[model samples]
Target chain A: MAKSIESLIPLSETAYYILLSLNVPRHGYGIIKYVEKLTGSRIKLGSGTVYTTLGKMSKVKVISVYQDRDRKTVYELTVEGSKLLELEINRIKIVYKDTLYQEGLFNEQK
Target chain B: MSKNKFRPFWSYDVLKTQDWLNDLSFKGYKLIKVNPVLRIFQFNKSESENKKHIINYDKGLDGYPIYIKDGNDYTEICYTKNFYFLEQISDEPNSVPSYNDLVSRNRKIKYIVGQMLLFQIMLYSFFILIVIIFTLGIGSVTVESIPSNEVEYTTIEIMSAIAFILVNFGYFIIQIWMIYSFFRLRVSNRKLEVFCGDGIDMSFTIPKDTILTKEEIRKLRKEKKLIKKTKVAWFYSPDKIEDWLEQMELKGFNLIRMSKIGNSFYFKTGLPRNVKYHVDFQTKKGANYFSLNKESGWKLYFTSYSRFMAISVWGQEYTELVPKYYSDHETKVKHAKKYMWTYLAVFLPAILFVVLSIGMSITLFAYANFENISTWMILSPLIMLVLVVELLFFCFKVIRYYSRVKATEL
Candidate 1:
């Protein structure tokens, strides 16, 4: 039960999906649909959760959001988001390379 | 008690009449049923309040012993899983405001659910309309068999019709749920005053002409006066209708409780161990005898719930028992999404089936005949990839709405 509250910290799944969804400048709803398509209908974000997360992410410089004359905040990943992606890729590579070496397949593959 | 003070309203939603043999106590009676959304309880009292001289009021620790706290002398009234409800009754003249506040919590929840239901209906109807419009063009798509040069009608019409019916059937289900919620909301609102200790009614429909004597009108006037309109704020059964009546009768004075046996209402009243029976004829509108409507006064109702007759009691000071088992929106949303793990069970299979279907459909139409078989064979995987992408896009749209489900408590 205590674990559930900790799991809902919002910056992980919501942030990742929103960042990926808005490869182009997209508004709140358009991001929702894009994420749905990307995930093959796996992740559905409630409207409240969506807006709240977007507001938080924007404040932290993870994603940049601006109004496109129509006054709807169209959101897109920023340089900071790319930095996050690089960090994630490096960590994954370390883990994957370590596993590959431990399994002794690196000798043949390399 | 201050009529406007917000108090703790305990609610535990358990199935009807099933034994909740957890740690619980009853000084006055054993609880029968509790509806959190309605904010009411049904219980069976072994003794009546009128005859019992020593009516001990306790700020008793729930799931423990009930005692009369007179200078710290705590007496255990009874040891059982009988429900004791904690509800504030307004000592003030006006009680609506306090009562409304309590009832409003439920009202807000009910309203949100109703809005969501209406949204679902609109969406279902929109899908059904699409299916119908597509069906209109289905008949025009005729097929000619290239091999035999024979005619064959496309099955698009049949598929369209089936899809239309399925959408309507889904809408029908939502309609039933909407109706049930509507009636439940109405009942909960109407019954608020009874458990609040003031028979509250802001508007009264007193008849202009009466066939009965002046005495009858006076009685109603008395009842109307009992109906306190001044809002002392804070808002907010089953049964063995007879056994409870007999017990109430033994204690003296007549006892009345409200029960619903279908669409209509039934009033079960008892006169001091004398006799117990149904008294629907004595009721007005759907109101039970005096206060025997859903939140009727000082009464217990036994209902056949789950498997046994669940008993519910309403009495003075503590009017209703709402057991909070701690399920909320988050719980439900969590529960729905928790099955995401279960998606693993079908995820691989569904993907494989889709991939296989694409592969077969592509292979079956090599060159659209046979002369250009090699050319079409080379194009097959590309066509399959395009089809798969379209299918995935459609699937994703539907799945996204259902994904990220919020947890709900039961």
Candidate 2:
């Protein structure tokens, strides 16, 4: 599982999920909520981490920053950012099926 | 109380000064008194007490230059050598004229005043020459005569304005160049290397560290031979400092404002023991200072013991592993981002006025300074008018700034 995680762009597991959540334009808090829902709260994006990552992402041009037509900074996935999200989604699909097939008779152990 | 006199870098660093003092003492240069940055010494081994070698150790802003006196003539040597032990107190009870006595005997202030007067004359002549060169040089290119017709005045006025700007442009640039040559510093990063006089090989920005560390404060106390002093840790760069701050909430670093010196921050630590990656820069001087802590500081100074210039551990010493090369290069280019603001801020337009004045004077001079009038007598009123206006403007600016300061304080 760790090997699978390492196969993608070098991002902390939390950053990948937050970037994954921002497939649509999202505000700062919205991204946090979306990451919590998507990762089942397994990855908590701290405020400092989120703000600093947003700054870094904007600097690298991975994400496009926009005003929400009302002055809040709205972040949307650029084509490059979208492609990275696609890779994560595909990896999760593989993991999802592998777990279901391998744990059918091992379910009572939990 | 013997006050010592010292020169610049040459007499100390290049001359192997401390050794020279020992040699001079062996040659009989008696030690008199010592100060922080100077040492005064003299010797009287004759039937009549006389001067042999007057060697001094000095540290000044432009780096130290030493003055040596041998009787009828004197030579000054300047270099970057540590020569603190150039003199030791003499044991003999003696009443001979000290070095201070000799300097008082040699005041050529008369010559200095003459030089200053000559300087004023040359400056005045140069200003007139520059203006004349511009006028005659440009005047030769203009139409032989202004059109006798009334309709041509507009074209003539337009041409005059353009010519005015061109002459002023050259004049102002030259003035700035002069000021820069006279006062712009050529300070090699002094703290980084004790310049060996052979070459300046290294440069680094050591924070003035003006807010002396606790260790530094204690050392200062020891120098003053005091019983105690206080210590504190205030950060310089809050962003880099945030990494070491205990709390998660980013609190800004505190700063103290000083009237004469400007703002400062202070910090202190024990003998740094943390092992981490660092940058090592060694210069011609045997001294090496590196950083491994917050600023990654470790000194391999010659004044220290045998371990001076030795590297303990700094980020797996790789050859030429400079951090952030691409961004650093980008910063090196003077992008002129604030060019217009700087031009206005430094009053470069005044350069235009100065050039205009000089060019006008020279042109008027070459044109016979209006023949009937005495050139200087006639020029004085106009020059005074210009000077008065300039002084009034500058005075207004200074007064306004002071008024703003007073208002803020109130």
Candidate 3:
């Protein structure tokens, strides 16, 4: 058996973005566009990258095929996927707080 | 005036050949038709425009419309068994970039290489088995080693033996060459850089001192001073493509096009200079992939079903150029796993065949000289030998591929 989800913490940026975009069911192309828009065009997902990521995510039960809408295939996050995204977001928030405090760039939050 | 011509090129020289096609387009000629297997291309006279022919290695035409929608005004021109040609005509002065991402491109490379390894193993095993069966059948009838009869070999038997040895020797050389070429390409390209791009259409400022005006390009073309030449090479040798292109540039022949399959390189006369060539594999290209590479100051020239080659032009003084796309260690390991799975899938059945062949040979030996069997009985041992050799060769290839992956991992 593969490692547990705990061991796979801190998902890659692309993987994290994909999970975040799957809050609503989105097709492969839709996920790409959504991620780009969310990141202000800073993260333009390549078609191959999205295809491969989707396959990997599906295999891990993190995401699944929502529907086969004509020419496009849509995917949505599973319960496990949403949980992972929540964990990752919290991890990022902690990291951000730690970095700012360590660098003495910010004071305590109100 | 319209003109047409037919030319044959090797299947591996697709990069230089695409460049040659673009050069022709620049000189008022456009590629119209190409036969993938025959490596033949047809070009017709046309007016010059800022057009680029993209030869990309991809599995199929799926999502092809995305390319058109990406805004290069792309049209599906033609395709070979593994690659498709997309022609992008832009009224703008420069070419639009490709749409493949670095990670996916790297993945595509590993996948294709793994699949090819599996195919070679399966093909060679079958071929060896057939050859062994035929040779043993013919060898048994020669009456050369029957215990009761005098051991005298016929002239035909001796000639057949020689032919068998020669054929195996030739096959061994070809296999070795394939491995060597692959390693050469891998090692030479090890220095390629992996960079993150902004994924936008932005041009780098070319050194103002080195810019060539349109007038100069036209003046040289009108002088009829341009020289063209073709060089053929083995399809697996992408390193050779780089070396030959560099050598030609040193001699003042600028690469113009690579034959559709990359078997031939077409060059035109130019000032002796330096150029760097790099290759990446991408089965499915994306618009952002091109935007990334173009943003990095690389030009996409040739693509086949599995790989694409790009070039960087600089003066002779420039060296130590970084590549735009390179597979990382994790990707290499993943590719290794893919190759291992394929090897196992084929090797399991191959082992069964070997066991069966050994059993058949034992049975044949038990019956040897005891039963009045036809000459066909003698073929058992030969077929077994061939099967054993095929398995060994397969193992060797698997090991080599694994080692390459491991080396990359390290």
Candidate 4:
């Protein structure tokens, strides 16, 4: 049975960035570079971290793996994975809104 | 002028050979050619400055040398089999070219080791067969069957036999020494892997510069009450061994170090704690493999020498929620299968050898008279029978572990 999308909720920072970068199929090194770029150099995923994360996500069917033309192992997010990403983005939006509202109140009180 | 030197077994210890070559270059003798078959080194005397020599085992894709063209600093001096002798003219030590792919380099070493082991096994089997034949000829003949006068061997024949035995004994000693050197090479290769990273990416090598002095080490050792224990053939069943180590930690024996070959484990007495142990097998590990695991707080205890199916022991202390090295069921099952197949491959040939010996002895007993059969012949097969049974048991344990992992959903 496929695991519920909710069970994989609260994706790790590494896992979230990895899934986000997997919009297009990418190999291990490619994903590392993509994640570094996507995060504006804030996150540089090590090859081992990418490899283990891809393995775990592949196990849960959140990501699918295939061999590219050059025989490199490439990964891309699955349909369930896209949905999980969307859910995470929505959750973040709520937190972002609350923080902004609190900042406005603090400014008014000052 | 060219000078020739004979070093019959130089390739067995490559690092030492490299150092020797470098030393020669410093003395103005430049390597011209290597006669691998004849075990000779040809050098030409030159007034050139000291140049660095790098011996690389070239494993190129599609049967070609990887470093075909000369780089900016280093040029190929000569080629012999898979080894390419490279020379750097620049005096700067840091500018000298070296292998960046440690995993590939170690794989080549593993290949050489495998070939040497195969040769040794063949030599040993032939030697044993000759010994068995001689013993049978001398011990099985009855006194009544012999002529009234004992048959005498010629002095030349006796002398030849003595020489042959001496040669074989010397060869046997050389083989033992070669085995020891191979172990030393493995230890050094693993150290290189850990300290130098792949050279392509960032390295997270544990600093060795902060090493404790002898007196400090002795003081620390006394305070910790360090103890050492040896366990042979631990790789045959690594999972059980990991559990055993973890259990020992719970009993206040925290594992501090493991010997180079992963046989001897050193521990220091400490408070009872929960520590998860993982036995990871990887065919090749990149710099990222070490960096990522280290970043995740897993302390690397031991890593086997061969990059081809290398085994590493990693441990992490936790108060709760046992950490999973492979958080997924698929990866865990795959790891178990790797253990099963590796042991199966290693033990299958051993089992066949044992079976063949037993079969040969049985046939010998059936064809020959009971009185003619020697006790030694019978004893040899009996010993092999016990060995085959033990090997089969180990195979069973590995298979069972694989099946258990396969059945488990997690």
Candidate 5:
């Protein structure tokens, strides 16, 4: 299961934002608004994209979705999902470090 | 003074009916009451300004609030069953009452069409049976069979037969009119879906160079150039049907169309390609359902008649990973269980009836003399027993499918 979780590491921008927004349980509409706000109104997700992505993530055990008291579908990331997100964040951090080193070398040569 | 008018099949197009009612209101006749069963519209003369009448149909609106303030724009005048009659209070054209959910309103239309289709089929079949019986009764009698003293009675019998035929003929004409209305309603419903921004643009134009004349098309059809084939099959479970459809597509049979009732599949022979199929069932579906699925590139293949407990078949050709509709384990299990329970609910009562009749027949056979019964009397229960066994087998398969779905909870 961990190895399979490793395979899910390069998540799409939409999926990553969706997972990030689901740190606290939120419905589809809430996730859309939260992601928009998080991205400073840059990444506005369509209901269709959010819906399909959530369905796929749920299928792969990355997230759990259920209906709340108002019968609105709410999504939350699972433990496996948290691990996947952590791995992705670490990969991004390493990429950022490598880019900083490359920029420093270019600056010295200039 | 009050005026009454019989407007049959007006509910087929609620918008048009609303417009007609508003027109009447403009002419001083305001709609007072409606007799849905008799298709009567009761109107009373009114000297007041023209009022906008809105006819709204929603099954969920039954027994709800009859009068809603709606920001003082419109108020519900009356409600019967699922139909709500509302009048615009502001008398402003733009301020007329409108449904917030057009998809559900259209769903009600689809439900009515489905029910009307079923009723039409049953009525036509029964009428045909009656006609056959009447013709047979008449054909079996000869002119000599009637005595001269009973000639008056024969005339009365012929007159009554004519009256029966005339009454049935009138009813059949009304049924035909209802069918026309249903067709129009369906067309309008498709337009509504597009209006709601949920319908996929399926309009494609034939290139000028590739256009064929009628004669050429007929010749091509005669030469079997069109490789379209239709196959008839029925399955109770969605999962089983989805797998079968996917397998068919894999085998180079690309499903192009489905029959109205959804039992027949029309496919065009093509190269084997990977395609994912999803059979979605929803008791109540909104426009969002279609728009969401359509946005993901799933082509709508077929949708069952009624929107209430409707089943839709969707497919998408994919080159890489197989697409999943209900990706989560819980949703997948729940869907399977829904199919199982629906089939069980429908077939259980039928199975019980067959079993009880068989039991009664067996008990009678054991007590009474067996020689008195005809061959058909004995054979009928045997056939029913076979049907009961087949239905039980089907129920078992559906239950097994549900359990299998539940077992994959990882």
Candidate 6:
């Protein structure tokens, strides 16, 4: 049976970034660096948050340890994670469409 | 060369210790090492400037720097059973803050302070129980009652009595001090408010959006005239405290005095200028921690076991400084969570102690039917009674403090 993405509708900012960064296989430090750079230094991942989040996502089959390099465990998103990410992105786009036409926002850019 | 000095600062005031260590550095004494348990820090004589020490805590760290991942080099100094203390030295004009994020830093500090409180309660009760047992067992056995044939018995009893007295006396002092620190933290957390009027005032708020020149600021200060106000407050939340103190200073109240055990601040009205406060939570620190902070512009004005509140006034260009305390939310939450772990650590030992004490009571009750109750055996039940009372008292304190700690969690 295909799992519905309804339960994962409201992903936390941390979880969302972790999943996005996991588009490529990366270890703990690698994921942290990727997230920081991806957000242009707006987001920084703590080791504790990364460790606990990976443990939780692994339990849900969203992410798994892809390989171990230099005694450091590397993690990658699974099929379930990719599906959830796609669904979340679509939901965000729907919200963006509803709000982009509002009075003051996006008017200056146009 | 000035001789090195050491002071015991174990209240988890990481920022204040850093400032103190920096002050020593400026005075020609350089901090070299720290011992957490002994609460002793070693220093060396050096003529260094623009030096600051950064301290970080992590539970499962093994010689790894959690923050300060830039060009700055760091060294692991000392650690307790479940924490690591790492230090970094910087000579740059403005040393980058170790913790730039406030939310995560608050969580980590709450966890550490919570755990420390729990451990303190356990230790206090254990000491109380020991004192009661020893006092009951051999405190008053008379030396005059010794028979001619049993001189050795008298000698043994006297020696045991002396040992019990010395141990209990030592533990009693530490237990009292620790309990006082706990109450101060708890009481301060509940009663913290901003005062601006004749009595304790809570409605005062700092005025914003006013850009005054140096002369205007001085004239305003002269008209208001400096007034001293003292208030007991808990700074369990680092993120809010910095803002609160900053606002107080913005209104011309400069913090001048802080109580050693209680969380009370003495604020004197001063010139309204650009000033900010940074609160850091650390375990005991040595001289080196202070030297690092002194080299920076921060002045260590307040201290508590879990709070190191410092104040600084730089120009508008440097007013947006972040605190260099805990680096991340994980570290912050880890310490607050330790508060719960402390209870877990005590659960088994506490259960065993209660069960054994109950069994001893039952045995003593049954033995009362056989013969004259042994004077020594009678003290066993007294010991049990003290343990139970101490446990009940500790539970009440834990409940009172746990609520305050939970309220401060981000």
Error of 1 at B388 (Å): 37
Question: Lowest-scoring 10 consecutive residues by lDDT in candidate 4 chain A?
Answer: A65-74
lDDT of 5 by residue, B1-410 (tens): 99999998777666778888888888888788888889899989987557787776544334322223334656656677667788867644222222324445555655676688798789889999887897798765333565658556678898998999999999878677667866776776665545433353222111133344558657755765434344443455566677788898898877776666677665656788898887776654444455456655677877765544467788889898666665445456667777778878888999999999999888878887766888877898899999999989878877877887788652
Q: List where candidate 2 sits over 4 angstroms from the true fold.
A: A1-11, A37-42, A105-110, B1-231, B234-410
Model 6 earns a TM-score of 0.34
Give each candidate's interface RMSD in Å: 22.9, 27.9, 13.8, 13.1, 13.4, 17.7
> Residue-wise lDDT of candidate 1 within B1-410, one digit each (tens)?
11111112332111111122121222444444444345444456443231111111112113321112221332222322323332212222111112322344445556677778878779989998877777786744355657634745469977887999999999788688667766566565556534333343212112112123447536744764211112111000011332444455565533322222222222223233444332111101111112222222122232212111112232221213421111134433432333332343344466667689777867578636667567656567677677667545544532442352331122
Model 1 chain B worst lDDT window (10 residues): B228-237
Which ranges of candidate 4 are over 4 A from the true structure? Answer: A1-110, B1-224, B229-232, B307-309
| Tens-place lDDT digits, model 4, residues B303-328 | 76565548878888998767667655
Model 6 misplaced regions, further than 4 Å: A1-9, A66-68, A98-110, B1-342, B345-349, B352-356, B359-363, B385-405
Alpha-carbon DockQ of candidate 3:
0.06
Candidate 2 CAPRI-style tier: incorrect
Error of model 5, residue B140, in angstroms = 11
Give the poorly placed runs of model 5, Cα more than 4 Å off: A1-110, B1-51, B55-234, B247-253, B259-272, B283-289, B306-309
TM of chain B vs. native, candidate 3:
0.33
TM-score of each: 0.21, 0.24, 0.36, 0.50, 0.50, 0.34
Docking quality (DockQ) of candidate 6 = 0.04
Best by DockQ: 3
DockQ for model 1 equals: 0.01
Q: State the local distance difference test value for candidate 3.
A: 0.55
Candidate 2 C-alpha error for residue B128, in Å: 22
Determine which window of 10 residues in candidate 3 chain A has minimal summed lDDT: A64-73
- Ranking of all candidate structures by their lDDT, best first: 4, 5, 3, 6, 1, 2
- TM-score of every candidate's chain A: 0.67, 0.70, 0.86, 0.91, 0.90, 0.84
Off by over 4 Å in 3: A1-10, A20-49, A66-70, A95-110, B1-328, B370-374
Give the DockQ (2 decimals) of all models.
0.01, 0.01, 0.06, 0.04, 0.04, 0.04
